[model samples]
Structure formats: C-alpha cells, structure tokens
Target: MVLHDALSEDHVEELAQLLALIRRGSAVTRSELVQSSGFGRTAIARRLDHLMALGLIAESEPLPSTGGRMPRGVYFRADAGRLLVAELGATSIAAGICDLDCRVLSSREEAWDIAAGPESTLARLEALLSELLRDHQAKVWGIGVGLPGPIEFATGRPVSPPIMPGWDRYPVRERLAKRFSAPVWVDNDVNVLALGELRAGVGRAHSDLIYIKIGTGIGAGIVSGGRLHRGAQGCAGDIGHVAVTDDQAVVCRCGNIGCLEAVAGGAALARRATAWAREGRSGYLQQRLTEGGDLTAATIAAGAAAGDTGCVELLAAAARQIGDSLATFVNFFNPSIVIIGGGVAQAGNAFLASIRQRVYSRSLPLATRDLQIVLSSLGDIGGLIGAAHMVVDEILSPKVLSLWIKEGTPEALAGAHAGN
Candidate 1:
C-alpha cells in the first residue's frame, strides 16, 4: 500500500501555488489552478483529491460558465485543525493553538525558573501540553516547541545553547514525537517568531524580512526570497553574541564578553536596575525591591512605562545596542523589512522609535532607503505561531505524508475515524 504523503518534492511547487491561491480567498477553477500552479491536469487532480480528503481543501459549488461547461472551484479550509504552539521565552513560555489560517485558538502563559534546567522545564512543558491537548481533544493537528536558543535544525536538538543549560544535544523532537504520536518540530524561537510574522503579522506585506528578538537574550531570524535562511548549521541568526560594546567586564551566557545580549538583554536591564536601586540612584525600582518583587524584564518594562527615568534610560540603551548590531545585518541582508519583538518589544513606541532612528542613521543610505523597521506584529504570539507553522509545513511535506498515509491516516480513513 502506498503511503499518503500529501505533497512530494515534485508536487511541492504545485502545493505552494495551490496554498497561495486558496489563501487569496479566490474561487479557482481547475483550469485556473493548473495555469497558476503549472502542473499537469492529472497531477493537479491527484493532489487536489489528497488535499480534499485531508480536509485542508473543500470544493465550492460549480460556477456557471456563460460560454462553456461549468467548472468546480476549490478553496482552503481555514479552520482545518488547531495548531498547538509553545513560545519558550527566557522567563516564561507562552503556549497557544491556532487553526489553519493562523488564528489563535487558546493560549496559556507560565513562569520559568532560571535554575530549573532543561529536565525540569521539559517536565513543565509536558504538563502544559497534556492539559492543553486533553482539553481540546479534537482539532489538535500537532505540537510545535520553540526554544530560547540555537537548535540543530536537522536533528531538532538544542546545540550548546548559552542561556539554557542541561539542554545540550537534547532529543526534543524524539521526545515530543513519542508523546504526541504525531509530527513534532523544534526550531530556534526567534526564527519561528519571524515566520509567524511573515505569515500574518506586520512582515506579511514584505517578501524580504529580518526579525530580531531582544529579551532576556537577543537574536535574529532572517527571511529572504520568501523563506527563512537558517544558515549552514541553523545558527545563522546568532546575533546575540555579536560584539557591540567592547566591554570585557560583563560575561554573557554564551561564554563571551561584551556581547550584545550581555549589554542589552532583559537580564542585563534587570541587573542594571538592581544596581541602581542598591546605590539609591533610582527610587522607582526601590519600591519593587521593598515589595519583594523580582526585578525582571516585565517589571522593568512596567517601570519604564510608569515614567521611571532610570528604567527608560536602560531600555533606550538596549535599543541602541540592538540597532547597532542590526546595522551590520542591514548592510549584509538589506531586507525590505526589519521586525523587532520579545519582552523588550512590549516597551511600545518608545523602544520601536529609538531602534528605527538608530538603524536609519547607521545603515547605508541606499540600504535604509526602502527599509521598514517596526515592532513585531505577532507580539507574544510570534513564537507559538511560528512553532505551529513549522509543524504544518513539515506535515505537508511529501515524505511525512507518505508515512502518515501508510501508517496513520489510511487506517483512520478505513475505520471512519473523525480526526479533528
């Protein structure tokens, strides 16, 4: 029996076009789909049948043709299944599920303990997924997990990430795959966030985009030619370690000195705030210390929003550092849009304005001319959505389709299983 891989390498080009046409909300006749997809009629018919059977596509009523026989049109089912996503942050993990059209289904936020390590954190993640999936037994397509550090793309394992300990070469994909008994994909958190933005966030309008995430750590996910550039080893956007300030005093999580993250991450901001409060230099943060609240990125952002001058200054400095590093990226990639997100991005227009001004000032005139610098459109949802996007993209691959059809969907189809 042949496996039910949805799209093979040969069918990828056509699948992409079909997805595009369906996404456009246009009623497309077979002839139109063929012309747009450049696929032979038989091939297109076969693929369309597979997609229709999978419930990803639906046939609309036949449209009347004035001068010819009526042709049936097809469109994408935006609510096929809920895509579950977990956007792992430095201090927290935001879990969300969405449908095919990238609309959020449900989301939950949980705190992270720095000393918890990978095993403990994974346990928490397992609990979270268990609860979310059980609650919505139907409509869950798969699970997508985003990490706060560099991930080996091929193996879906963490590769000596700086901030996250006890996760080196962790078999995240294998573990998740076993738990869900479904496709599980792992990716660098920032890259997934960028992908989320590319699909439905602010970067949607731009084909070439660069997404930088500044939080407890800073990194980027570069998208060029309408695809994410993961570099040779999936470490392409490790800009957090990029030297910016040249101060050899402070150490970074990546075992480096004077790194951009060391100077501008959320932890750095909190440390500076704590130092100022200890010196009695800032009364704003002192109130927090007195109240026994941990000086974190969220607290600092709140302080800055409340007219705390010291907090504002610290955030501005971080923005400057981020802009300086991005200037290099701007020169190298020259993407049409650059999006910044993460905890720091919650600083609102003040943070965005500062970064935009600096990037424009530092980048070459030609590079800056058409560049659009803005905050992330997905906000906190970027990571979750990106994770879901990864799973969806993979499950739609030909190889996965073959295996799933051979092992899972066929039996499901035979038994008339109502898979959500």
Candidate 2:
C-alpha cells in the first residue's frame, strides 16, 4: 500500500497510533477515539481515512447507545496483512500464518528437530509458510521466529546455545530477511511464549509476569512493566543451566553438572518415568511402556492422574526443583503472575500445585501474598501468536512507522520479494 506524500511526520505517527488503538479494541467508538487519543474529529477522520486506504481499519456493527444515534464501531481489518511465524522447539516446529490482528489464519506442527541446524530448519520453515501463503494473498507485513535457544534479540542471532549445535551466532535475521521482504524478529522461544500469554492468555490482565517453560528444557521468561526484559546479553532468563543440585553426577546437555534442566525438564522426567517402568514400580506406566517401549512426560502425567504412585512422585520432584529456583526469582522480580506451560507442564494441576506449593513456602511472605500462579491458556500456540504480535508492535513504533510511510510501496515490496 502506498501512503500519501503530504502527511507530516507527526500526522503519520498519529495515524499509526490511531490504527493501534483500533486494533487493541481500546477505542472503538468515535467519541472514545477522540477522548482517548486527544485527537480532534477532523484529524481523527483524516487518519482513519488513511488507515482505511491502507485497508487496515474497518467499520463494524454500530454500538448501542442510550441516546438517539448509534456510533459506528471500528476494528482492525483481519485481511489487512499477513504475518509469518515459526516456533522452533527441540523435537518439532510450529509454522503459522496470521492476520495483522495476530489471529492464526492457518497453522501446522511438524516433527523437526533444531539439531538439524539453522540452514535446513529455516529452509523447511519458509517452505511451510510458502505453502500456507499460496492461497492467502495479503501483503507480508513481518516475520517473527521463536527459537529454543538464547537469541541476541537485536541481531536475531543465536549465541552458543547448548542444544543447538550449529546455530551459534547464526545470521537468522539476515538470512530470513533475504528470504522475505518484511522485517523479521527473532527471540527466545520462552520469551515469545510469555508475550503470547501477556496479550492473549492468563497474563493478559497482569503486566508483570514470569512464564516458566518446562519442555525439553527448563527456562524462565521475565516480563516487567509489560515488556520483555532481555538482559545485556539477551540471556536474562536462561535459567535452564542454573545449578539446583550439588550432585556432580547429574550432567546437563550444556555439560554443566546438576543444572535445573538436568533434573526437572521434560527429557529428564521422561528418563525417570522410563526407569520406573522398567523396574515395574508403577503398574500403569509399566503396562504402557511394555507396549510402547518409551515414555514421555505426557504419559507420566496421565499415569499420575490415574493414581500411579511412581509417576506422581516423579512429577512432584521435578516441580519442586523448578519451584525452588522460581522462589528466588519471585523475591527479585516480584511478578504478579507466574505462568507454567510447555509440554511437561501438561502434567496438569498436580504439577502446577507442586510448584506453587514449594515456591510459596520458600519465598518471602510479601512476594507470595498476592501472586497468582496459573497454567497457559494458549497452550502450544502461544509462541506463534506472540511472535506475530511482537513484530506488529515493533513495526508500529513511531520512527519505524514513519519510515514505512516514506519507503514502503507495492513496487518496493515486490523488489524485497525478489531480493529475498
């Protein structure tokens, strides 16, 4: 979409803000848009016209009123643009195409490992997006990716991630930019998962939150003042390697001894469940293992829910260890919400209860007093949704929005497509 040439920088900013307000569902009515944004009727009308020209904002059903005339409600156009996202996990990857409002239009999950390295994995991921985009012909606005590794957010490069061997410092942003015309954002998988929760899940009402992911690895995503707090090196929440046990025998994938992930992650829990099955410690688990030959955290959770003693104990132990670390974080970050999600977190309420039990007991009274711990509402799709949202918010920043107004055009977008 080509923007008008006569728009001043301030007006362009106002237009972006107006579009954002409409998208957020915060100011839908004309009076609310004027009162909430402090923009006069004429300016608001002109900006709204610009957004409509961009095929962004649309008129919805009129809102009911107590007085004579009903006000027409405005909302973001779901077909305005498309965002492509990939959440790369340890043993699988999720690919999705979403509208500008961050709603998943179509998504598919496939069994693919990050150990396959960046080149091959990203190629496959882009192919998936291409397949989904075959029918959806909306303009590409952005691309966001969530990797199961520490990411240098500004550069979108991995940094010596333990599990991702060939991904260290790989040029993810550069490579993806070359593959697509839109801007690309890469971040830690857990961080984007927290973003997804903050906008759409249990954390939606709470700005300060800590999202703990317990899948193939154990990590924390810290959000303070409603934004992701990636520390100086983008390693703020790399808690998987935080030592929790003094047992030197427990070696982690990172070669560290007694790391939290070594004892409390999904793979770790699965190993223990396998041992129990082999020893015939839990009849339910043993019966399943006898047929399937292997166990996962999901099966262990199912076993525990079915009254299996060994499975129950194993999950409790993992949760307790993770909880010990979170207690320390609670005292420091003092987040209002603590969200537990990921494949292992599927262990259900019993698992979350175990963590909450240990954390509340270990943390200071004030920190634990009002803390609300809950499971994820978005489940496996949170990362993809959040990644798409992140890019939208990123592009909406004043300076970036102004740049898009200046340089963004259909011909330029076509050039980016060919260049990529």
Candidate 3:
C-alpha cells in the first residue's frame, strides 16, 4: 500500500553495506562483520536482525572449522521471491521462471519472430509466464527480458532495432509493469548471454571476457571489470555493423554494405554455401541443399564434417573474417577470455580452431598472451539466465532498497533485497 516509515539515510547505508558483505561472503559472523565493515558490535547485530526480519539474509549451518567453534554462514535468501525472464532472439524466444538466486525453476523455449513486433511477442511471453507462475504458485518481484536488438536500458524500450520492426521506442517497461505488477528490465539479447555465462558458465572464472554470438547475425557482449558495459546509447557491442569488407556487393539487414554480419554470420555463410552448391563446387553440399531444400550453417557444418572441402573452406573463411574483427576487439579490450557461441560456434572444432588461429596470429602479443578463446559453456539457455540475473541485481540494489524502505515494504517489495 506504499505506506511510509522511512529509514534514515545512515540506516539505509549500513543496511546496504551489510547486505553486500553477507551476499559476497566477505563476512558472515558478527566478528567477521565487525572486522570487514568496522561497525560496532551493536550495529552489526542490529543490522543483521533487521535484515533477517526483512527476509533478506539467512544463517545456514555453521562451517566445519579445524579447531575453533563453528560459525554460521550468512547467505542471501534466494527463495524469498521469484523472477520471470524472457530471452528473445531473431527467430525464437526462451522464457523461464526463476528464483532470486537466478535458479531456473521451470523453463521452456518456443519459436517466435521478433519481426512480429512487441504486442504479439509480449503477449505470448506473458502467457508463458502466467502458466509457469500458476503451476509453481510463485509471486513475481521483478521481470527481465533480453531482446535481439538495442534497448534503451533506462526506459526498457527498443531503439532503432533493425530486426525488431514496430518496436522502436516501445514502452516495454510500462506495458509489462502494468500487466505483472513488478519492475521490468530489458537489454540486448547478447548482453544477457554474456551475463548468463558470467554467473553460470565459463565466465565464472574470468572477470574480463568478450562473448561473441554468431547466429543468424553476429554480435558481441563485452564484460569489463566483471560488469556488462552497455555504451552511451545501449549499443556498445553492436559490432555487426562494423565493416569487414569494402565490397559493395555484400549487404546487411541494416542495409549497409560490407558489414561483418553480411559476410561471415550464419545467414551469410548459408548464402555463400548455397551459391557454391548452385555453382557445383561441392557435390555433397549440392546434394544436401537439394535434399534439404536449402543450405544452413548447421547443414554446412555437417557437410564439412563429411569431408566437403568447399564447406570447410567456407567456414574457414568466415572464421578468418570473424577472427579479424575479434582481433581488433582483443587488442582494444584486452579481455582475459573470448567465448564464441551460437549456431556457427557449433560448427565443430575446425571452425573454432580457424578463428582462434586467426585471432592469435592477428592480435597484439600482449592481448593474445592471456586471452583464452573458447566456446560458450551455457549453450542455448544463457540469455534466459542472464535476464533473470539482471532483474535480480536491480531489484536488490541500494536505490531499490531505499524505495522499498520508504514505502514500508509494500506487497511488490516483499521479496526484494539488495546492497550498496
């Protein structure tokens, strides 16, 4: 009901610091909290009690110590609330219902067209969420969505999304908030993929990494200093439009010529494969194209696996081209890891090897020295998990906590928790 019993600024600051310490496992017991936070014993005890009362942190079983008395481990209460996530792509969508910890309770994928615009796609996603929430009997504290285009992060609206027609500047947050009674977050789908990898996949080890998605189109998600970097206009990693060739013949979805996506992405590779088959360069690819009615990145990979040189060369060239762009990024960002994912990444080791070879050979020695080029560990569901994580991060931040405290923990804020 938005009732007010506002917390003082000092109280809110102390809560935020304590929350971070507990969540990050830097401090658990009163002694540890005192040492890390430098708060007096009474202050630590008081903050801990308040957090427990707010259903934010919980003390689990004590750790087994070598010789001293055991101390209980304080952890964020993941089960306190739930989140709904929709990971949208150019041709499909994956949605999930997850806990505050980003654990997927129930998840599913369905074929969808981003070109179908926001209205129909949003409705379908809500329908899926409704079904899942009903079955699980879960209440939503927040909702997260990853769209296959640039998003105006502050407003949760698409901005000049080439693939998402009729969705430009659409009020995604406003519409979704109205329907679900929760805060909503939106971002480019690849950014979420990077996030999913960071939390649940290979990115668990490395703080700095570049996540490249080479599907129907190509995009990169840059994680710098362990955080997703969405640039000034939320198009920081829009590398698809970056020119790879000067040839005027190659055209991209955004109508630009020689863009990387037009020359080396899955769609581009498939188009090249088809042209080769029609020209009878590879009889195997020709027969497969005839049988399947079209050539795709997957089919081309299969052909390459079956010893088709043309298919192999096609992939190698694409990989080299992609690697050239990646080399530039590696030099520019000097990330510790470079994860390649999506349809083209699944084209087998040869494709990966070619890209790695090109990147290592082309990039500066310093950047390449510590860089580890690898395939995505999350595979298909990374975006969904990332979306959930994004919402969870927002709902639990200091500002959101202040809002909640000011509102006296309304029903919508019941399960929300965060730190400074």
Candidate 4:
C-alpha cells in the first residue's frame, strides 16, 4: 500500500539521506546518524524508525559505551531483495543473482556468440536467469546488464555497435523490464568492469582510474572523481576505434582502417597468427593450427612461451601497438592506475611487460612517474559484480528512493525511471 500521503517530500529526502548513510556503513548508530546527517536526535530516531518499519534497515547488537547508554548498530537489510545481473561479452556471458549489498549468491557462465543477434542472445540469457532464480523466492528488485557495445544510456539501447551486429538501437532495458517486471540498467561491458574494479577490486582505493579490456575487441572504462564517466553520448571511453596508424591494409570490423582494435585486439592477433601460420613464418603456430584447425591469441602466447621467435615477435608487436595507443590516454587522462583485463591480458607477463615498456617510453614523464599499470584482480566475474552495483546504486538514489519509499518495494516503479 502507498504511504505517500503520510510523508512529506522533505521527510522523504531526509529519510533517503539517512538510509544512504546506513547502507554505506557510514552511520551505524543513532548518534552517528545524527552527527553524519546533521539532524536533531529526535529527527534521527524518527527516520530510523521509518526505515526499520519499511524493512529496509534493522538494528543489531548494541555498541559498547564508556558512559550510561549503549547505541544499537543500524545496518542495511541486504537480503530484503535480490538483483539479477549479467555481463555479456563478444563470445561469453556471465550472469548472477545478488543481494542488495551486491554480493553474488549464485552465478553461471557460458560461451555464447553475441553476433548471433540480440533476440537469440537475450532469450538465452533470460533462460539462464530463470534457472538461477528457480530455487530462490526473494523479490527481484532490479536488473543490470553489461553489453559489448556502445549504449544510449538514456534509453538503454545499443548505438551502432560494430562488433554487435543486429544490436544497433535494440531495446535492451525495455525488453528485460517487460520480461521480469523490474527496472533494468545497461552499460558498455568495459564500463561495467571499471565499476566492478572500483567497488570490489584494485580500484577501490583510487578515485581516478582506467580499465582497459583487450578481448575480441578493445575498449576502455574511465572513472573520474570516483564515478564512471560516460560522455555526452554515453560512449566516452570508446578507444577501440581510435586510429593508431595510417595503414589501410588492415581494416576494422567497424569499417575503419588501422583502428587500435584492428591492430592489437584479440581477434586481430588471432587473425594475424593465422596468416603467419599459413605463411610458415611460425612453425609452432602451424603445428598448433594443424592440430586444432584454427589459431587463437592463446595459441600465439603458448608458442611464445615455447620460445618461438616469430610468435614472441608477434605478441610483442601487438603489445607495443596497444601500449602506444594507451600512451595517448595516459598523457591526456593521467589516471592514477591503468588496469588491464580480458582474454588477451591472460597472455602472461611478457605481454604486460611489453605494453608497460611502450607506455613508459612514449608517455609524458609526469604521467609515467606515478602511473601504475596492473592486471585486473577480479578476473572474469568483475562485470557481474559491477552490473549488480549499477542497479543497486540507481535503486538507492535519492529521487528513485523517494518514488518507491512509499510503496516499500521498487516493483511498483519498474521501468518508470529506467535509463534516466
């Protein structure tokens, strides 16, 4: 039942602020809430009571005190609802069910092709989510998705994603909202990875950072001032298409010549490896191809590990090209750290060393002085966690919270503030 008539807008705002404090673990007691929110003791008590009545927060054991009265610890009710999240890549999908605190309770990963089109991909994803949700009876508060393409943040639709054919302008959020009766948030996969790292991985301590994913394609997620920075069109960090060379012999799937992804992405490296194998320039690659029928970036890395000079040179060349492009970003953005992830980053230390060498050599001195380039610590599950946080952050924002606080459940507000 709606309680909008009982609470004033000012009261709702105050309640949201109080809830935010508790949810972030910033204020764990009545006194802490009063001090953090600058509210009178009575006002803090009233807000806490309201949140507790709504089942959004609860009081735990009392804190130790030196004086007379002990304060009970206020905590967010993380298990009150569940969130469905998925990270969709060029050739794989990772889906999970998370609690309000963005903790994964269950997850599933499968190899699937995004080029199969949005209809088939989303249908398969829906089936996977259904399987994960089958045993749980928790309320699904929201859905978050990370796609391998540019997205229109306001509409949650893809915007001419080159690697994702048949996905341009697809209604991802709308479809998912209709399917599950929950609001959905969609973003580029790399942006999701950046958020995951920011909240759960190496980026937790650093406010300004860049997350670069070198998979079938290469993309970047930029975080400035501790927030994901999606530009005006929500495609700010699309470094994959940045032109790195004037050569026209190499054409990108985006119809561009010598773009960074075409020169150094996992797909590009594999394509080059295949040519090298065909030309007999790499005996190791030829043997691997003859056995496996196709060469991949992993094959090249394996050959390099086996001391194949041609494979090592190939890997180094791709790394140097990627690093050269990254040097421009380092000089311009001056991020505190640059995190490398995705399938290509798994090529081992030699690939990382090559990229680091070029970045340090080509970047400005001041930028390189304090810069730290490292691999992603979260590995494959980063996007799923990021997707969970994305939805939680939105659902818990002031405006959205105000709309749903009266209802006690965001289910009534599904798709109302989606993509906003």
Candidate 5:
C-alpha cells in the first residue's frame, strides 16, 4: 500500500487542515487547531505525536495567558532544510534557495543564452548548484527547475516547444537527478511564475486567476479554485501559439503563421526598436542603447521610463495586443484576477496601467467587476520560488512522504510537521 493511502480518511482530512493552518503562520495553539481543523482533540493530538516522532514537528511550552489557562502550541521550523529553485530562461539562468515560508534566502544568476541548447545550459545549472550547495550545511529536500517550454510532468521533458529548439525531448529530470541524487521536477517557467504569483505574489488574495508572461516569448498559466490547470498534454496555457491574426505573413517557431508570439515577442519588439533607431525615427531608444550592448527588456523598460514616446507607444501597443488576446480568456474563464510577469513586466506601472485599461475597457462589463490586473510582486524571483513550490507539492504527497521518511531529510520532517 502507498504511504499516503496508509492513513485513514479522517487522518488525511486532519492532516490537510493542519498544513493549511501551518502554512498561514505556524504558531497555532491546540484550541485554535481544533477550531480551524474541526478535528477531535484526541485525533489531533495523536496525529501531532505521530508527526513529532517522525522528527517533523516539535511542541512548545505553554504561552503566557491573558486571563485563561495557557495552551501549548506547535510551529513549523522554517530552516529545517532547504529547497532549491533553478529558473532556465532563454537569455539567462537564475537560481534561488527558499526556506519553508517560500522566502528567498540566497539567489544567483548567470547568462548562458538558451539558444546554446540543453548541454551548455545543463552544465551551467550543475555549476550553479554546486556553488550554492557548497556554502550551506543544510540537506536539500528537492530540486525544481523552470524551463522555457511546456513540460511532461511525469518525465520532465519538454515536448515540441516552438521557441526552444533542440530541447523537445531533453531529459531534464533524469539529468538533474543524476547530478543531485534527489527527486527533481521540471515545469514550464511561466507556469512556475504563475504558481509563485498565486501563492505568494499578486494572486494570493484572489483565486481563479490568469498569469500572462510577456518576455522573449508569450505564454499564460491559469489557476482556478487555487489549483493549476496543466491540461491533458500540459499545454493548457500555451497561448503563444494562438492564431490571433489571419495574415499568415510571418512564420512562428511552431511553423504556424500569425501566432500571437510571432507578432509580439521580445525579438519582435527589439527588431522594431532597431529599425526605428537606424532610421533616426526616435532618439529615445538610441540614447538608451550603448554601443555593442544588446537590446534587452531592461533597455526597453528604461526607454519607456525615460519618457521615450516611441518606446511608450510600442509598449502600449503590446499591452493592447495582449489585452486583446486575454479578452477571449475573460469570456471563457472569467477569472477574478490577471497577473502580468516576465522581463517585460519590469516596465512596472506604465505597462500595468495600459494592460488594465485595455482589459477592463475591452472585455465584458459583468466579468470586469472585482477583477484585478496587476504586476508580479515576486519580480524576477517568481520563477525560482514557483519551481520550489512544485517540489514542495510532490514532497507533500503520501508516496513521496514515505520516501522522504526513508531518506530522513530535514525538509521532509518540516513538511510532515506542516501536515500535522
């Protein structure tokens, strides 16, 4: 029998409630736990002791009471172990270490250019992981990688991604597992960003949200009822390939024409900026660009910030186009929130204001009420933490929990405690 199935239904329900309470802020008293979890006192105590014996939870002495009997409490240890998050992007690879609360403890970045393909990227990731693990004494719980394309969750392989060439069948999970000797998970980078936003960033206060990432490429990740929807083929959020225009003029990376990404990706924006600059059509981007310095999302963000009318106009247009694409989503999903992230989102309020105006004005009025259009609060850290959350989810699973028990990693204890 699976370790998860070993627990009774009542035990599972109590455990789920315990995790939710601990995740909110671990310092729950027994009385409060009973109220929040709706479990009998004996049952809660029994489960707590089981988790404690697993080295997953520890109890604290009674607290000072205002006018009543002091109650003993339990709390999750934030630094019991470590979670590693590596974000693999088209232009750079960023890695971060997060504790139980999902706060970034340490992070580092290196540019290797995703165009270099899987081997070079994997090598860079290994180097970064070594450097990060070398300085810390904590045992790692799991490793989560955020890749540039839709992924197969079971195998951790990208499947026929448009922009990411030569990576369609990359064995990311197996390769990472061999290096780390721990469970590893790979997911679409934007999906991880959406997860980050949903749990710790802008989408925290709202469920039924859509997270759109506009960067080197365009994609969306959807969360409904606080759960990610990856679809049957893990391509539920592959909005970049949606045929927005019927022109058939420019070919997309997927061999399709008039796809949204082909028309509005960062490469498209950079090419337009370069042409305008060459023609002396705008001095704004010219002033922002340094000799031999590549045009980047930061440069574009800086251009818009510097009051470059052309850059601002281009951003607004991109926002309108994105908004147009999202209108269809609004009609279908009617989400309560929409979060925009990725390099381009660094444009901040200027970009957010435009997208908000377009989405609200163009979409249906009934759907617009209580709808939130916001930028990612996680900033560049979204991908990393989202990756970590993926590992955490698996670690929280019953079968994985049993494996974690056998491994005796400190993070497994922390997770079990959160469940209790």
Candidate 6:
C-alpha cells in the first residue's frame, strides 16, 4: 500500500486506533483488527501498512494455522523511539529511559530532596536523565515526569505544593522541554504510581482500584473504569489534608489541623516514635536513638519487629488511622483493589495486616467483601514505569497522533504541547 502525504481525519483516527490495538496486544493480527475495529480487511491492511511504513509497527512471526493459511502477528515497534521518565519523591528521584511500551531500559535512582527547589531538583533530574540517555541511540520521542505534589496537568506546572517549596507555579514542562527538546507530561507522583500499577503491577487485573502512597506524606490515586480520575483542579486524590480527627493539637505541614498526614503519615509515625524514645517509652527505640542520634518510621518498624510494645502500639495506631481514612474512600468509591505503597508501607506484613484489618472492620460489608488490599508489587520502580506509561499514552493518543503522524516524528509538536 502506498502511503499518502496527507491523511484525512478518518484515516488518522483509524490508523491511531489500529496502532493502539496492536500496542496493547488487543488485536495482534489483521483478522483480529477487523473483528475488533469493525474495519474491512483491506482497511486494516492499509492502516497496518501505513504504520509499518512510518516505522511505528512491524509484522512478527506467523501464528498457528487454525484452518488454512497462518496469520502474521503485528506489534508496535517499541524500539522505534525512546521515552525519558522521572519519578520525583519527597526525598529521592528515580529516572529512566524506556521504550515505546514503557519498559525501562536503563534507570538510576538516588536520594534528593524536593525542598531543594525546582531549579536544583530539575537540574539533578536532567543530569541523571542525560547520563541514562548518553549511551542509548534511539531517538527520544517524549518525556514524562512524576512530581511529589499537585501538578497543573494542562501546563505541567506545580501548584503550591506543600512539600515542594519554591516549586509553586514552576514551569516544569517548559523547562524540561527546553532542555531535552521533547514534549513533556507531568503528573502527581501517586497518580503515576497508580498508572504503573494499572499498566504493569497488581492492578492490571482490575479496572477500578485505588493506590495509596504512605511516605513522608499521604495521598491517593483513583482509577475508575480503567481511567485515572484527577478530578477538578487535578487534586482529586489529595486526601492527606482531609481532617481525620478533631484534635486541634495535631497540625499538618499544610497548616491544617488533624489532617490525615498529621495523624498517620510517615513523618507523624517518626515524630511519635522519636518523642517516645526521648521519653524512655521504648528501650529499643531509645537505644536506636542513642546509636543513630535520630529515629524514623523505619526505626519504629524495627522496634516493633524487636517486640517493643511502644513501637507496636505506634504502628498499629497509625495503621488504624490510615485504614479509617481509607475505609471512607472504600465505602464511597468501592474500588476492587486498594494498593498500599511508598517508603512507610515497606514496614512489612505487620503494617499491611493492621491496615487490612482496620479497613475490613470499618468499611461497609458489601464494599469490603470483594476488595483486595495489597502492597505495591513494583516497589520503588512503580513511579518510573508509571511515568513512562504516561508519556506513551499521551503521545500515542489519537489527538496527539494526528498532530505528529504526518511529520513522522513528534519534534514539531513538542514545542506546541510544551507551551513554548
């Protein structure tokens, strides 16, 4: 099939749909495309040929013959381009280069504080990405970033992030775009984690689920009907600031009283443990403080593991608080699965058991009956994988594809999408 210089809207849509089908492994053969897309054999052939001509997809080995001729398998050409992805946490950064399918090819992770401000933080991210991209030969098609704060999705700017000081209204996408010359997409870190789970982790089996990240702070990412629900102002899952208690003494970093983060977040657990250690409540914690000079959520977990009643009580209390907050969401959203992740969640099975127990006890019977509460399967790499998927999803969408398919590359579309 000869490729046309100018594609009609219908042609573009069909081509995008066909490519998406193959990319997702939903329709890997010409016959499957016809059945799935309601397009004739000839139309599917033309679109597949066009995609191959553009180096976006390729024909693979023939499938087993059902009756007569064997069918050739079609698949997205993942090596056709590369995607740069970075998942920034409150105190660390994970950056990687991924193929078109969002599989990480190479990655680097290190401790880095978000409080270092946008300039410093992004510079480190760019440096790390550059290092990872240094040896790869594939052309970078786009960039995806996950930040530990609320991001204005349209502009890819930080929106008064409580933990990310000096990042308010920062032009994240524009800066990264200028540095890398690629279209950039930014989202909340938790949202990217949820995306990672949906694409490559435990949530892959369920379309409706919630991912809760408990680290320096707490937040959630909601997926409904296989779509991420960011809600109005792109802060739908900002459950950290929801008042979980009426205790005026408990203050959150966001200046909110009795916020869930103040009661059940990593910092809160660490604070309580440290105070207990200083007050001689736990001999293990006190010894740990004497040796390390400070305590953290990990210290509390360790103490609990060592059979310290104080640490056990502290973790249980925090877990119950988190579970109570999660119960409300479970009752309202009724997700099929709830994924617990982040640094604090690494406290092991006991912490997860406590959370599961509380959630099941507090939630509605119908909602809890079928819900599965589990820990993150991807661990620290979930954000990186999720960020990669974010870029791939956006760049391959029909609307964005229509803008760049004619050019055979997204280079020109980069500036337009980056708000340059």
- Which residue pairs does candidate 2 place in steric collision? 178-420
lDDT of each: 0.77, 0.86, 0.85, 0.90, 0.77, 0.90
lDDT of 2 by residue, 1-420 (tens): 236548687887888888878888889988899998999998787777777676677888988889999889888886767888989999998999998779998998999988999889989998998888886877788889999999999778999988998999888877776677667889999999999999988999998999999998988898999898889999888889989988977988998899999999998888888888888888988899879856999999999999989889998999899999999999989999999899998888999989999999999999989999889899989999999888887777776666666554222333332334
Q: RMSD (Cα, Å) of candidate 3?
A: 3.5
Model 3 segments beyond 4 Å from truth? 1-6, 62-70, 406-420
Span of 10 residues, lowest total lDDT, candidate 3: 411-420
Candidate achieving the largest TM-score: 6
Give the per-residue lDDT digits (tens) of candidate 3, residues 185-264.
88999999999998889998888989999999999999989899999988998998899888988989899999999999
Q: Model 6, 297-375: lDDT tens per residue? A: 8888888898999999899999999998999999999999999998889888899999999999999999998899999
Quote each prediction's TM-score: 0.86, 0.92, 0.93, 0.95, 0.90, 0.97
Indicate the residue-level lDDT of 215 in model 5. Answer: 85
RMSD versus native structure for model 6:
1.4
**Residue pairs in clash, model 6:** none
TM-score of 6: 0.97
CA lDDT, candidate 1, residue 295: 85
Off by over 4 Å in 2: 1-9, 59-65, 68-70, 407-420
Q: Candidate 3 vs candidate 5: which has greater lDDT? A: 3
What's model 6's lDDT at 367? 98
Q: Could you tell me the TM-score of candidate 1?
A: 0.86
Model 4 clash count equals: 0
